[model samples]
Target: MVEWFVGVQVVIAVLAGTAAIVVGLAGVKPNDYTLGATLLVEALLVVQLVMAIIAPAFGNVATGSGLEFWIYLVSAILIPPAAVMWGLIERNRWSSVVLGVACLSIAVMVYRMSQIWFVQLA
Candidate 1:
């Protein structure tokens, strides 16, 4: 994964997650605002997937275990959609909280992926 792109993903995920949590705390139900934010996080993950596919061609291969990185990326990509589905089905304030938690989880996963990609064993 690209370092700068990973940074962007983490920042956006954190911002979106925080916003969703605040909205949830305010007793807001499942709404477009939270759904859209989750979608944005999912989109970035899709982009990261594409980058992973092509980055090796550019000599930007991971420094750590490729399997571990792929597992993290794949799991991260799935969390947002699952959370969104749960939110849509439940239609409650806690749904927004779920989305926020999912985004935060994605942020953590993405950071782990970055570490796996860029570790320099000396």
Candidate 2:
């Protein structure tokens, strides 16, 4: 788990969340720009996933439950695409709100992933 990579993920999450919220508040339907932001964040998640998979080979094992970490990783990967699909189907301002919530959820999951990687309980 690289600290800098997690930091970049956090920043992307924030930006994605902000974009979604602003679009929602403006009462606009989903647009390509908003969807693209979510897609970009998703792409970053893929990078994070790959890094996590290989981190153990470099001797960077999670201090917390490995199962939990994997669960969070899988959920993080699914969220953006799910939200985007729902938005496209719904075709309303609420779709933007859904995207906002999804982005925020991804941010939380990323933070938890870091905790699982770096924090150990005695």
Candidate 3:
């Protein structure tokens, strides 16, 4: 995986998480801005997924189990859309909280993915 690409992902994750948290704390239901931010993060995740899939062809193989890394990537990509959908269905402040938690989870997952990409397992 590309280090710079991973860095970009990290930054996006942080922004996404922060946005979610702020929206949640404001005690509003998921609105256009929150949904848009979720979608934006989802878009970035799709890009990251594509880059990850093609990285080995470009000779950027992960030192850990490829399966584990792919699983993390796929999970990360799914979180935002799922959270948004759930939030829309719930239609409450708790929905915003759900988005916040999902975003935070994505942030941690991305960090773990980076470790999997750059570190070798014994």
Best by lDDT: 1
- Give the Å shift of residue 35 in candidate 1: 0.5
Please identify model 2 stretches exceeding 4 Å from their true place: none
Instruction: Quote model 3's TM-score.
Output: 0.90
* Candidate 3 lDDT, 1-102, residue by residue in tens: 778877777777677678877878888888887777777778878888888888889888898888898899998888898998998899988787788778
Model 3 per-residue lDDT at 12: 71
TM-score of 1: 0.97
Q: Where in model 3 is the C-alpha error above 4 Å?
A: none
Of 2 and 3, the candidate ahead on lDDT is: 2
Error of 2 at 112 (Å): 0.7
List, residue by residue over 3-119, the lDDT tens digit for candidate 1: 899999999999999999999989999799899999999999999999999999999989898988999999998999999999999998999999999999999999999998998
lDDT, candidate 1, at 50: 100
What is the C-alpha lDDT profile of model 2 across 43-121, one tens digit per residue? 9899989999999999988999988899999999999999999989999998998898888889889998999889954
TM-score, prediction 2: 0.95
Model 2 lDDT on a 0 to 1 scale: 0.89
Order of candidates by TM-score, top first?
1, 2, 3
